[model samples]
Target: MSTVAIFLMIAGVFFFTTATIGLLRFPDCYTRMHAAGKGDTLGALLLLLGLALYNLNDGFSLAALLVSLKILSIAVFIFVANPTASHAIAKAAIDAGVRPWTRKGGKP
Candidate 1:
């Protein structure tokens, strides 16, 4: 169980690092938002799940189970909220006439 929890945390960190890189490297808001939305949502879920599992490592109690459930509920909230927020941001940018990046020669 500890091993699994450790793996989950590590994987979550990896996704977070990739997302940071994408934010730094992507040429446009749309692509950067894509990276942030997808990577952050998954990373947060994995990290929260790992934390919940780690909390249970001491042994399962009603209290521990409830705590884990709460953690998972937060993850569920992030899963729903992040994408919706990203979409709204993208829509606002489009409405404001922010265009996507294009090739220098005006090609796809």
Candidate 2:
């Protein structure tokens, strides 16, 4: 159980780091939004899962249950909001005629 918790934490950190790098390096709004939105949702979920598991280590208790519930609520909120925001951004960009990035020498 402890091993699993540790793995989740490590994985969460790795995902978050990748997300940050992608946000910084990706060209154009769509690709950057993809990196940030998806990565953030997954990273947050993994981190919250790890936390929930750690909290459960001491056996089921009221406080532990509350903590788990709070984490779950946060994860659910992220799940709902992240995609919605991403879609809105994409739509707005398209309406504004924002161009996507392409390979050098590629035709637009």
Candidate 3:
């Protein structure tokens, strides 16, 4: 259990690092959002899950279960909310006429 929790936390950090790289390297707004939103959401959820598991390592009790449940609930909320927010941002950008980057004329 402790090992699993440690692994999950490490995985979450790895994902967050990748997301940072993607945010820096992606060509355009939509692509950046896709990278950031997907990676960040997954990373955060994993971290939260790891935390819950770590808490549970003390042994399962009613109070411990509730704490884990609360942590999981937060993860769930973030999982649902982030993608929706990202979609909304992308839509707004499209509606306002932000154009996607294309490689054609970007050739130098």
lDDT of 2 by residue, 1-108 (tens): 667877998899899999999999998898999999888888888888888787788888998889988988887888899889988989999999999899999986
Ordered from best to worst TM-score, the candidate numbers read 1, 3, 2
TM-score of each: 0.97, 0.90, 0.94
> 40, model 3: CA deviation in Å?
0.5
Model 2 residue 15 distance off true place after TM-score fit, in angstroms = 0.7
Q: Model 1 reaches what TM-score against the true structure?
A: 0.97
Residue 94 Cα positional deviation in candidate 2, in Å, after optimal superposition: 1.1
Clashing pairs in 3: none
lDDT of 1 by residue, 2-108 (tens): 99999999999999999999999999999999999999999999999999999999999999999999999999999999999999999999999998899797954
Stretches off by above 4 angstroms in model 1 are none
Q: Would you list the clashing residue pairs of candidate 2?
A: none
lDDT of 3 by residue, 1-108 (tens): 999999999999999999999999999999999999999999999999999999999999999999999999999999999999999999999999999888987842
**Clash count per candidate:** 0, 0, 0
The lDDT per prediction is 0.96, 0.88, 0.95
On the 0 to 100 scale, the lDDT of residue 52 in model 2 is 78
Residue 30 local lDDT, model 3: 92
